[model samples]
Target: MVQPNPPVLEVSGLSMHFTSGRGKKKTTLKAVDQVSFSIGHAETFGLVGESGCGKTTCGRTIIRLYNPTAGKIMVKGRDLSGKLNKEERRFLTDNVAMIFQDPIESLNPRMTIEEIVGEGLTVKGKMNRAEVRRRVYETLDKVGLTQEHATRYPHEFSGGQRQRVGIARALINQPSLIIADEPVSALDVSIQAQVINLLNDLKRDLGLSILFIAHDLSVVKYFSDKIGVMYFGKMVELAEGEELYKNPMHPYTRSLLSAVPRPNPLTERFRVRVNYDPEAEHDYTSEQPRMAQLSPGHFVWCSPSEQQRYESMMRQ
Candidate 1:
């Protein structure tokens, strides 16, 4: 059998920390701690966790929005670490783009939708005025927005429509990797499905790779091929979406799945409650936690005792 190609984006030992104060009073907050994962070409990889668990930070760091304090971020075999020449930075920008959660805030209120979508092309000097307009119109049509809507301000559109504009802007660059950070979290339940379907359609139509970050496991399960569960500042579980949902490895993952509201009332009644003390502080002063492969294509981070207990439980 022929082996598969390597992933389009590979992140290894990625870590991000924030240092505050000075002298003996200096303190460090590990926003993203030793995370590693890969996204195949055209794959939808989902990262799910609570609000403050560093999901957004990880996504931002991968795109170089936040310069990672440590580790490697490889895009199509090129490591984005050292300062790149002007042209190289431009190339990276064109290859990877992000779609933020709030479309209203993400889109400049001053700019028309056409200008917003065409901004990337304008910056890259990729096309003249006529060509830019033509391309922008085409992209708008692709995202289910009319050419007329292009002239309207972001505030004029509904939440879903504005998000479509955001998607259009990201897609206009024709990026290989699009990091969608909680793209549907803000939309109404009815509109959320529409946006999710639109994203799925775009992935198929454009042959795009997406790193979808969200806190909802059900949505992530529907959109992702593989899922990585984050807790605090670490990835506690990584596995195929279906497998992870059926058999969660980490305690955190299990707790999350247990809380998913099932459609069946009977099953929903049996849902387990996960308790985490928000007021309690975590002690991270010891040796750094390391992730270990628990099975083929599945990984988890746990103490030696916890790992042994997990293994014994699985064997039972």
Candidate 2:
């Protein structure tokens, strides 16, 4: 069932750096540095990291919300940097959709559900009003929304219902890939499960390629087929979701895994968090670290010596 032919989303050496302050006081902050990865067709690739580590920036940049300072972003083998005609540009927008973190802020409060979800349909001029209405109602139904809710404004719905509208909006275009940036992070715990399950079901039914971004490792592991762990604007580790959890080679990755809360009361009470201090943990002065593959699908960002250290640890 693993189709590794063409990647739905591919990014290479992507970097986004910003400068703050004025003149002499200006300091350059590298938000995303030389990140590279690809999501195969229908595969859910999870990007997990702490806040300000550039996970959201990466997602936005991929969707062309923020232009990249360097590197390439290819959607379905078409490079965005190339001269895109009207059709190609339209193709890009239609194929790639994003589910924002905060549903309330993402959805226009003034717009009714029908207008919001059917917004994408406006881009392609083929559908008539009746057809658009039918499509909207059907799509709303797909997201567990009733047709009766279409006339209501965003403010009328609960948090979870608002998110369903967002998802409906994204799916209206029949996008080949979806970048869900902390989609469930803002919802209540019970509501979060409902949204997560909805996404899971949609992926199964629609064969969606999802770039699921989140700060929670447990959620990432549950939803992702593969995962890439970010640290200080760099991809420190990438592997199969279960593989990464079972065998976290990078110090930062191991530290993150240690922090994921366990269900058992005894385990939670005695769990010790492994802190990660970049300065103390790595000495990149001599030779800069790069992403090195330890196994077929496992990659860790480390110097040559550190790579060997991880390999040795895996052997034991």
Candidate 3:
């Protein structure tokens, strides 16, 4: 029998918690709880949820920005859940790069585009000025920026152009996985499409795997091969992009889908939004719900009875 290939990135039972205050006054926030999923080589895995739903926290935790409270994070089948040596830390940093949300905030106001894009190369060490300049120019060109733009600072560029700089910076390192946290959210609607198209082209050209994190379901549907819907800190539903959009089993997932505005006038006029309240949606006081495989490559968090209901709904 042949063994299956491991995912480029896999996360299992991952959790990140934060405590504020001191002593009894301290409050513990479960920023991310038991999140699990994987991204295949060259695949785009979209994570969608509302603000404060732990989507960004989960992405940051995967890239080792914060120490996980529990669970495992595997990069190309190599476990990164444990403490790492300096060498391991450098390796991880080189392999996983992040594209932050706000372009202006992410880029240094004082640094020119060349310095911003080539910073990763500098951190990796031993590159002379000319070598760093060459890679920076090459990466900038790839992201639709010219050599002229490289001489300018972040404040000199428009929001869209600033984001292009961010992309250039992420691509300069040639990372295996990119954690893009709401990359286009702050841009104008027209600029959003341009940036999205640029990312799609780059992904295809680079054969890159991305963990695309955003609150917009429509954008995620356009970008992801697989989609994971997060609520609070838990992933309530996981499925292929089309499957989840067509038949969302979890109540929270359904509620989220219903809220996305449609272009059709009649449909938009008649659509009723679904409001999901966890307390009203589930009876977790008695039988607990575990993540269940509802179908091939589809998973949902539900009790046995709820699972049966979902199965029956699919049948209908």
Candidate 4:
């Protein structure tokens, strides 16, 4: 899951470990390791990486779906890292919502749009059936659907429409922070634009903070004010979107950016893809590596020597 935009929340040394097998065969996997970043109150923070980099895992961990092995998850001065009490649980449920990746899989085919979108209100028992129905229609309309569409099932809608339904469900709670996991990946190019535009409009009108996780650099750059690039459960680079694109410091980030196809035919032809093999890139034998600031709002995971080198490179 993602954040609202600015320092309303902070995650310090967050880690999630999964252990499997028995005895000698037992092994532990650190899906997220010492990952730390703060998200603002009403802005979009784009998280990008190749598959299996712990983007989704980190989000899930923050949302408390999986217990963290170690670290602190703080929101609005409340430490939410460990087990949550009833009040903390209520706070989490009220302020945060997630729109999952698969449009079809995320929604229950048996349930109508009204049922799915109004579930939050119904669960809290704060509204009657008529009120829930009215709120559901209003929420649905916010995402580009109409009151008449509320009775339709998931099977009755297109992929884009289904995604919009998912959005409405998340919005019905009037959440401050939304963790949208690859929300547009399953749709066609045209539909992706529509959904993204809807999100932008909603963000502007409602002042929402979003944690947007996706593989599309173009979309991430366009929609996010800040971007963090993750690699192998670590955030390799993070900065404002413009700074990240203007000057990517980390080798892995450079490698990732090199792969993005430029629109200009001349530049695209000349673009050199940087192949980043982590083992070959750096030697952590003599020194341990950690996240270090090369400049304000620009950070890189590096050892002391590497930080010096990066500082030198920036100067050059």
Candidate 5:
């Protein structure tokens, strides 16, 4: 039997809660509530949800942009949740990179593409100017930008070109795990395809594990090997991309999938939107729900009774 490669990213019971006000007036918002998932080497794990579902917050927390209130984050076998030592900090910087959502907002207006892309290497203080420039050119070339474009400022380039510059910056570090928070959401449809294809090629060539966060399930389904659907602050459903599309067990997941527009006119005319009401569909007053394995590689957050109902539905 062939053994599988170890997971590149592992998160368990991750939570990020924001607190406001003082004393009796304090209120806590659970931005990410006990979320857990894993990403395999060279695989894409898509986190899909509606707006304000904590998808972006989850991605930010994993990369230590925000200190997690609860849970453990193990990236490349190193614990990243707790306080970091110098080496741990170095490890995080060297092995992980992030691609932000807004292309224009992410890039600095004053900096040329060369300066922006090479900043990571320059900050390391290890590579000299010549080395950084050379690497920046090579990285730009990898992302389909020519050396000539490197001298131009962000304002000089189109939206797509600017996004490519962002991608080049992320690639400059040669990271193993990339947390892409809606990397293509801001681009035009044509531009989105180009960027996604570039990312696919890079993932194949570099064997990089990607945590892709997006609100569009159709986009996630196309790019992800595994898909996890989040609702509000919890992961409601998770399975292989195709599996989740074919068999969405949770009411919230079903509602989300039902909203995806169809290409065919006939299908579009007949598409019925599913409205999900948690309070109406679930009787959680008696028993609390938890993430349970309903089948191989499939999990749903539900109580025992709900699991039984889902299992029966799957059988049919």
Candidate 6:
């Protein structure tokens, strides 16, 4: 199968590190190390990994919320690196938006829903009050919220409703790309489904591209066209959603898939267990783990021995 053209959001050699402690005792923690991937226009690219694996930091870095220690972030063919001039920054803001993890914490308690949704427009100063109100109502309706709900504070709504409000705020600007940083992680299971469905509907209706970041593989499988697995700040595997789940490469990806609960008791009982020796430390100086193409559009970054085994297996 032929792969598509260059993606709308192309990240190459993205790296982020932070220094901790003071003076002579300082140590650098490589939060995100040489991660690279791309999301096609109107595509949902999922990032799945355990907590503290730097998935969130990767998302923030892609949007330039945190300056990358090294690497390039290209959105719609525009480089968003270094300090931007005022006009350039404004243009970037209008083009990209983020849906934070916690809607309650992200939304202001003092502000009304209308004010919160209109905040982006107010800051951009591109539309008048009447125009902003019209756009806000239109966005609210698009996310399944009513104009009446707009007058109330965020606290007035339930968790799912609050999330809808957050989505409305992100969509009000008509951004081409959105980074949904675990948008449904905080909600109840039922509410989670509702929010996911709402996001799907919005994505289809608005023709927006998204990076859906979450640890839940099942959710990622349902929502994403392509999935990338991160481990210890490095992207170890990336493939189509079904292909990755059906034939996972890399030890870490296999281990993650093994943990996903099976519906059948027999299958669950027979599932393979992954054992990683905690005493064994990660070695980063070796070769930088170049990605080996397993098949069309499927890639894995593994050691030479593992890559040989995987290649042999695929040939069979």
Give per-residue CA lDDT, model 5, range 1-316, as digits (tens): 2135557898999999999999999999899999999998999999999888999999999888899999999887767888888888789878889999998899999998899999999988998999999999999999999999989999998888888898899999999999999999999998899999999999998898999999877788999999999988999999999999899999999998888887889789888999999989999999999999989999999999999999999999
Error of 1 at 175 (Å): 0.3
Can you write out model 6's per-residue Cα lDDT over 235-294, one digit (the tens) per residue?
A: 989999999988886778888888888679977898887755422523445634577788
Name model 3 segments beyond 4 Å from true: 1-4
- lDDT for 279 (candidate 2): 93
Q: What would the per-residue lDDT of candidate 3 be over residues 175-204, giving only the tens digit for each residue?
A: 889999999999999999999999999899
74-167, model 2: which lDDT tens digit per residue? 8888787545678777878989999999999999888899999998997588899999999999999999999999999999999999999999
RMSD of each: 3.1, 2.4, 1.7, 2.7, 2.1, 2.9
Ranking, TM-score, top scorer first? 5, 3, 4, 2, 6, 1
What Cα-based lDDT does every candidate model obtain?
Answer: 0.87, 0.92, 0.92, 0.90, 0.91, 0.87
TM-score of each: 0.93, 0.96, 0.97, 0.96, 0.97, 0.93
Clashes per candidate, residues 3 or more apart or on different chains: 0, 0, 0, 10, 0, 0
Worst 10 contiguous positions by lDDT, candidate 4? 1-10
Candidate 4 per-residue lDDT, tens place, 42-126, comes to 8899999999899999999888999899999877657787889988988887888899999999999999999999999999998
Error of 1 at 72 (Å): 0.1
Candidate 1 lDDT over 56-133, as tens digits, reads 999998878788988888887777865667776787787899999998899999999999999999987858999999
Q: List the residue pairs that clash in candidate 2.
A: none
Shift of residue 304 alpha carbon in model 4, Å: 0.8
TM-score, prediction 2: 0.96
Question: Which candidate do you rate higher for lDDT, 3 or 5?
Answer: 3
Candidate closer to the true structure by lDDT (higher is better), 2 or 4: 2
